[model samples]
Target: MVTRRLVLSAGVALATAQLSAAKVFFREHFNDEGWRERWTVPTKWKSESELGEWGWTVGKWHGGDESNKGIQTSQDSRFYGIIAPLDEPFTQDGDLVVQFSVKLEKALDCGGAYIKLLGGEVDMDSFGGDMPYQVMFGPDICGSGNARTHVIFHYAPKNENLLAKTDVRVERDRLTHVYTLHVKADATYEVYIDQTSVRAGRLEDDFAFLPPRQIPDPNVTKPEDWVDERRIRDPAAVKPDGWDDVPKTIPDADAEKPAEWDDAEDGEWEPAQIPNPDYQGPWRAPMIDNPDYKGEWEQPMIDNPDFKEDPLLYRRCDGCTHVGFELWQVTSGTIFDDIIVTDSLPEAFALAEEGWARWKDKEKAMWEEVSKKEKPEMPSFGDEGDDDLDEDMAAAMDEDWTKEEL
Candidate 1:
């Protein structure tokens, strides 16, 4: 039963909702002082002097006071690895969902702001990118072409796939936004950005986890003499006389020599050439439908010989033990908070409302205020370029340097 209700506020809708039925695997609000005990940075990351560090803060702005807090990537151009395991291991016997909130407060260029679910023994000291993970869900933004939320499944005996579509972008805003991925036991999945679903489909149709049901027959081949052309030149049409003889350009008849023109000083004066109005472009015979056109040729399809349908595509997720963030960022200031992995949609909604929904407006207001302040003031220069100052720019210099040269 995969379901998502557009919950505006957790207090109003799910205030009495009980989480006992959901069997939560993990939840991290990061509001407690002992949050340091919840997450761990890899030993390799700690020893390396160049790696970025993590910090707990309320970020630039929020609806609440210091209570609104999350773990933030506090440095630039570094690789970070951290993980926090659930109490125990559990199979995907029912619906599995992973969701969280992220605020990309500054330059969010190239980075992996996603969360990973892994199942394995402890090697906390050495955990890094090479660590195997069962599932990875969240946004991965690089640029326009590579911005998207990924829902990956790492199944045993060879299975790995990024969420099946292209350009499934994430919320790239300075303010807070919730990202949720719900994978149902029924083999369908839904990806939500906030309360609305942006993408949803069957697991088989979306991911190439199973072999195709059909394929082109190997025994059958397209005939070499197949008349696949739909149209051809008209044989009955004849070329008009003197079609090629028409000049493409001619001297401007209206143009005249100036009175100061000198035949000796300047090469013999001649009117500039112009496109000949009477000239015809390269002649092409009018095309008529070919009587011998056999339409497009296609190889006959047959049952895929190597295909074997797995009735349990949903089971490919298996399960996970730990959820972590192993990412690389070019420029940091990304804050991650309010993480939860469970089966209850209401619980997810409850957390979203208590966290993101409540603080989003305040965050937006702070963002607007910051953007207004970030506007660059017109720097005064000598009188040379002052005359060239654009009216709008002179009044308010270009805050964005991308539009024109300085």
Candidate 2:
């Protein structure tokens, strides 16, 4: 018989082992002042002073705990680049999950608030738009038609070829919202916002993962004599003799010249033309069964030589080494925080619940409160001192003020 202590010890040991095996690439809440140390700014900002700078804050007004600070873009019409290294390069065999929180307090008229998962050796000091990344996930807003939540991944064989889906869009608001991208080993993917799934599809089926399975044989061409038209004018039908003679318009026979009209004042009067009721449209032979027509000719399909089936198209994910933000904002103030890169979807979701779900209602309440508050009435001209007035205007203003006070 096993003792109770032994069972307790075994339970604790199992839990410890499981914890060690869990794959968490990186997680950041930005709760500590030391967050500045963990992230790096691009070197180009030194020479190019016009570029935006990053600031840490809970925004002008935060919903909940002010301690939950996020990195925000602090300048308008400028570029920004910053990156942070993960605890380790994610190379293990597992699914890829990236998640983060964003707050667009200013509506983000034009800008990108996306985060990139960079692989290989990335020059942290100069990381910008040019640094090749393995995955990019987040929101980008520009004008009317250009607003969307980007879910893109690089094809390693051809870096230029990126897998991008066009379904999900950014949650445009002043509240903190979560964005999650879960790419599974079985070649399926999903994009979730605030724990609710907005888009899901099979990676191999949705994206151009490989060359098509079949194609038209290059050497073969459609025969010149092939009659592919399905319908033609009936040769037996004949046009009516008067079909073309009918006029489209004719003078109204009921019209009589006005009694006041004079020959000298008006040119020869003509009744206004009206649509001819008898007129049919242009004459044409009726369409009938095309008995001699061959069906649409298709080029003979042969097995495509270039297509090589990838049983594991989704498995091509090489993993990520660093998380970076490269952006250009016309209207600044987008906060990014609560980022996570992990192999476990549940872990990412848990963060979403804690970070986003907790603050959503409070933010909404705050927004409604501000919106309902009444604006203060503007004061009249004689209410107070108008120091900027010229000498003559000032004397006249003083006389008006004295009269009003009296």
Candidate 3:
């Protein structure tokens, strides 16, 4: 027989083992002073450089107030790229979640606040829009089509990618909010905004993961004699007598002749134009079920021979050793912090609860203060105290000011 203490000890050991197994594939709070050593910024960026000013600055501000530290954009119309290595390859298995926080300190007119997960160690110096990436996911607040989080997966040869059809909109205000993308091995995915699940669906259905399951048969075609129209003009119907007698226009009953009008000079000043009520549009026979109607001529669907199903839509980039951010910010001053990639939801949320949660309240209060300051104050009328003049002013103001304007 096993002793009670032995069972308790075994349970404790098991719990500890499980907790230890929960690992963070990659994380960068940028709070440490030695962040430059952990991450690499392209040295080829400058105002006169082809990549333009990579105006990225690492500092602390009360806007986000998370750890009093974060990476932010310092100038407008610039390219900012920062890449860092991951502890392990991030594949689509278990529960891969990419989470981060973004605060649009400046109203973003056009810019991307997204991160790219490249497949392997890439030439840091040449990384830009042309670089290949496995996953590019994050919130992007910009012009019309870019006010939501982008969740794109690299499909194949460079430049080929599929974007998630269902994405959640992000707040563009100066308050910090968390964005998370959770993808599983079974092809199902979920997007979260500020710790709340906003969208969830299967990757195959939500995205064009594969070619269509069925396609129109190329061997068949609609017959030329096919009556595709549901209704046709009755051949036996004829126009009623005097149908052409009704004119399209008539003299207006209310329109009076202009006193300065001269019939000889003002080409036919026939009373101001008015609609001819008696006139009816071209007449047509009452629509009846066409006897020869063969219904819609839709080509029959055939099984797509080229279509192939992929059960493992999520695969660990066997060599994806780094994650980076490469984007153009128009307004700039967008702070990014608390970035983490993991295979456990609890682990990801735990990190957020520690970093984001800690300063969210303070950030909220600060934004509220800013809003209070920036918001236009409403105009106030009338005196502070009620006096005889108040009643007199109200009465005097009751007079038609439009007619008495001085």
Candidate 4:
């Protein structure tokens, strides 16, 4: 029989394994040309003397040789390597895992290659150059005093070093040694050297000591406490008396009535005089009011939570009306087309609510049934009587009780 303690221990072990398994999402293998357009070599890495013209290199998998003709060199005789762009955006809730194979040539100084994950910039050169979130790996590859291979972590653009000077070494001329870097969207980063995990910590506070300003672009904005004047519109431009004002009109109550007016007519009657009922003189149909409408008639409510608060909803022009509502599930990566569209919002909400209600009810009923079921009685240790009333005395008492003699 399985004990409760044993079951609980198994559950805890499974949970721990799940947490560790959730570390990375979406790994990109540069085996093809899909990511070629997203990366670029920055000027710092492009200059000579450091690696000078030899900053970066890439090609089809081959045995070690810097002179291999297939290896592509960086532009301007500097680090010549390709940068690949991610197909999707990374958010604070996402995780990225980057793995690469590097075999350094004997002449190649242990400078090691750099892999950077960045946001807020679409282009590679503009990525770490100035952005809100970035992670650099160099100091972690190289060990202290080794100065050859390093894995570094830099946060918030401007290359403000969150971590630096951690030296890493690989077995010399090792073929295709794989390195993995795990980064959480919440500013937590970890480095894995070979198969072992190393250096895991929060990025924001650790990298706070570096210089706040590094990018030289005067036009680019930095993350700071200052207000964004561009986002704030002039109050006068949006005032009621300005563009949004409604023209004043005083109605004359005694104005001439319509030609079909009749005093005796009431309750859904047709006009008294049919001016052109069968004449077919461009008849206009009656308009139906949307039953679910809440706000102004010109602007309808958007039921989708993702787009409800979007500014585009409030910028609609006057006199525009929502004909109907649609729920769309978009599928294509490069197109605005949707895979499915539904006509009713309430139907979706009702279905979701019903599913949740049934699930909760079933769980409650199962637990209640388990509690009510009978359990085996435990042996009682309440009495310690008549140890000596055994053997012959017990036999004589049993016979007397059977014969009704005492």
Best candidate, TM-score-wise? Answer: 1
lDDT of 3 at 256: 78
Over 4 Å off, model 3: 1-19, 45-66, 90-93, 157-159, 166-168, 223-226, 234-236, 247-276, 289-294, 375-406
With a 3 Å backbone cut-off (N, CA, C), the pairs that clash in candidate 1 are none
Clashing pairs for predicted structure model 3, backbone only: 91-316, 119-320
Q: Pick the candidate with the highest lDDT.
A: 2
Candidate scoring better on lDDT of 1 and 4: 1
**Model 4: what TM-score?**
0.34
Q: Rate the local accuracy (lDDT) of all candidates.
A: 0.77, 0.78, 0.72, 0.34
lDDT of 3: 0.72
Better candidate by TM-score, 2 or 4: 2
lDDT of 2 by residue, 1-406 (tens): 4698899999888766655666888999888888889999888544577678888988765676889898999887889888999999886366888999998765576789999988888889888887788788899877555678988777866555455645476787667788999988888898998888988988766667667789999999988899888889999999999888999999999999998878787977888999999999898899987998889998999999998877657753475789989888876778998999888787787677787787788888886675454333322445457654344433322222222210
- The CA lDDT at 148 in model 4 is 32
Is 1 or 2 the stronger prediction by lDDT?
2
After superposition on all CA atoms, what RMSD does each candidate show versus the true structure?
7.5, 10.9, 11.4, 34.9
- Cα displacement (angstroms), candidate 2, residue 343, comes to 0.9
lDDT of 2: 0.78
As for lDDT, the candidate ahead, 2 or 4, is 2
Off by over 4 Å in 1: 1-19, 45-47, 159-163, 244-283, 376-406
TM-score of each: 0.79, 0.77, 0.75, 0.34
- Give the RMSD in angstroms, all C-alphas superposed, for model 3: 11.4
lDDT of 1 by residue, 26-73 (tens): 999899888888788888644576568898898876777897789999
